[model samples]
Target: MIGREDWAATALAEIREMTTENFAAELESLEKRKRKKDIERRIIEGPKQPWRPTRHGPMREVILTVNKDWFSEDAAFFGDDQATRENEFGAHAVAWLKANFGDDVIHARADRDEAAYHIHAVIMPRATVEIAKPKAKVPTATATRRMLQPSIHPLIENYEAAQDSVGEWFGGLGLVRGERTAAAIREAREIGQTPPKRRYHAKTWKWRRQEELRLKADARALKDERLALDARVVKVQEREDEVETVFAVAEGVSSGAFVADGASGQPGLIEAPVAKETPPSSPTLDALRKRSPVGFARASGVFGRAWQRMFGQARVSAEAEAAAGVADAMQQVAEADELIAKASALLPQQTRTIIAKIRQTIPAIMRRLEQRVKPVLDDQKQDGKGPEKPRRE
Candidate 1:
């Protein structure tokens, strides 16, 4: 009943009032057209109703509605000013109907005094429209074509197109498409709240609405999980950076290499900030210290293996963290554009771009780290030392 109107009453009252007011010129104009052949039958039988079977019943006027959701109070549909939005929507709707149905669109108007906004349009469904002039006949035609023959133009043929066109029109007014409005209604209902009355009677729309709401919820959950993963990746990167720093310092100290000028303003060995007692080397390794370079290589190889084991574990943990982040991001890719946009907005622009790149590059980073460590492990194996566990520092 929300969009329903008493069209029969309006039509009868308006027509009778015009006749009583002595609209002679209007009567003359109407008479210029063919009169109904069964006027006496119509009068006796009380005008053939829509529910009754009649030869011309299919040509009766169709009542169509065009409007947005009323109940949600969604700003996209209701907007800041209701009257202005309704008027604008009406103008667009009437124009669209005219464009589609041409002169067959008899009347279209908006009614504001209701729980929801909507437009009621009366469309004459007479599809065999008479043209003012006949279009040119093809040269191949042997006989003359009748100029007065009406062209068949079915209104129901373009029903789906018309539905899509209406959606596109409303979208220009900042309203989401019909499905979105339905989803909002469904969501409200799922949470034990009453939603606004539905415009359509079809149950499929309700199901679709619920599905959309679920998808929206899934998208939001995935976004939160992604953000949490991003934070984890950042922490992992920080820890990796710290490990690199420690490894670099250890390399400089062991090799007795020049520290950067930024540190000492000279190229010389830098003493450790706090000198610690060196742990006792393994007897076999200590004995090898006086041996040839090959023996020293074997002893150093043990320490190298220990460092590799430690950092290798760190690398695996970091990779696992990155992989989880990437998985969350990939799931987001399958979500609707609206959900994805909302999720993306939660992160900074640079961070979003970087995360995407990290997703793409993480596997390569892992492979490279593996390649760098593989040579040392291979050298240790080749040195013919039974795999001795390195002492922990």
Candidate 2:
């Protein structure tokens, strides 16, 4: 997927394309106006004399081509409106040129006629070496007096007449002059010097080391957290297994018979009910005898007569056999209940342990997240240190 930076770059490229197209159309219109004015001036003046074009015409004409690139779209500095943004950017570009090249910056103006808005500028000595040297400083008083002097020569009158004859279109796109100092110009040139390359190598190595450490820390933290969670899961599962085993045993034991009170010769025996509405049958003596042999023997002395009444014709030997089966079933039920109770008592402890483990893992999890994010931040910082690539067409 495309990232945020990639999207921003694409948007900038589109803006540059729009600006270039717009600037080209405006330049064409300016050229046409200049040509039309020249033709009209020649017709009125009649041939033979050397015709000097207006200052605006020569300056505007010299802006033969424009090279555009997207700058920042900082709304705080450029303002909100598109027109305002375009104008602010144009002004900044012009200022930058003037600071770098001094008086060689002859003209600069923004063109608005095309779909894409941009600035057009003219350089006096197009190449760097051809720039003129600064003139010697003169007294402020003398410069002020020269500016106030009135025109006297007929040629001066002719110049003013020519300027007045042209329409607004021929003059509106002229350049504005700006202040430039010798110190500022020197500083701008100094910026072109190359810095030592060794410094950058050392910085890159340091950044790489820090990134490696951050990655290791992140891995360690994640591993710890996963282990903690696994331990908790194991504990919970073990408790559940214990509980289920006890419950299964209890169910098996519940399906049996047992001896009860109220009997003379033989004790009364309770049996598992066959159906919800049906009355239970008396358990055999053999079943009771197997469950509690001593009790059965003791009861036989006093309840032998009652046993005959409750279970008529049931043999003592047969009842004793049944008692054995009931005793086994009762033992299974008792063991099941004991196992269930033991597991149930341990369940809360297991649950609490699991919760504690989760809590213990939280700090480590957060530390891992921080470690994972650190390298990305460091990479960004290193990227910021690298020299910016110039924007191109």
lDDT of 1 by residue, 69-137 (tens): 543444565567564655666666677667766765555656554446666566544322221231335
In model 1, what is the error at residue 133, expressed in angstroms?
A: 20
Give the range where candidate 2 is weakest over 10 consecutive residues by summed lDDT.
141-150
RMSD of 2: 31.9
Candidate 2 wrong stretches, greater than 4 Å: 1-204, 256-339, 345-393
Q: For model 2, how does the per-residue alpha-carbon lDDT over 285-393 read when each residue is reduced to its tens digit?
A: 4654554454444333222223232233222223343344334433433343344445566667775464344334323322432343345445544656422355798
Go through the candidates in order and give the clash count of each: 0, 19
Alpha-carbon TM-score of each model against the true structure: 0.26, 0.23
How does residue 310 of candidate 1 score in lDDT? 33
Model 2, CA-based lDDT:
0.39
Return the top candidate by lDDT: 1
**Winner by TM-score:** 1
| Native-referenced Cα lDDT, model 1 | 0.43
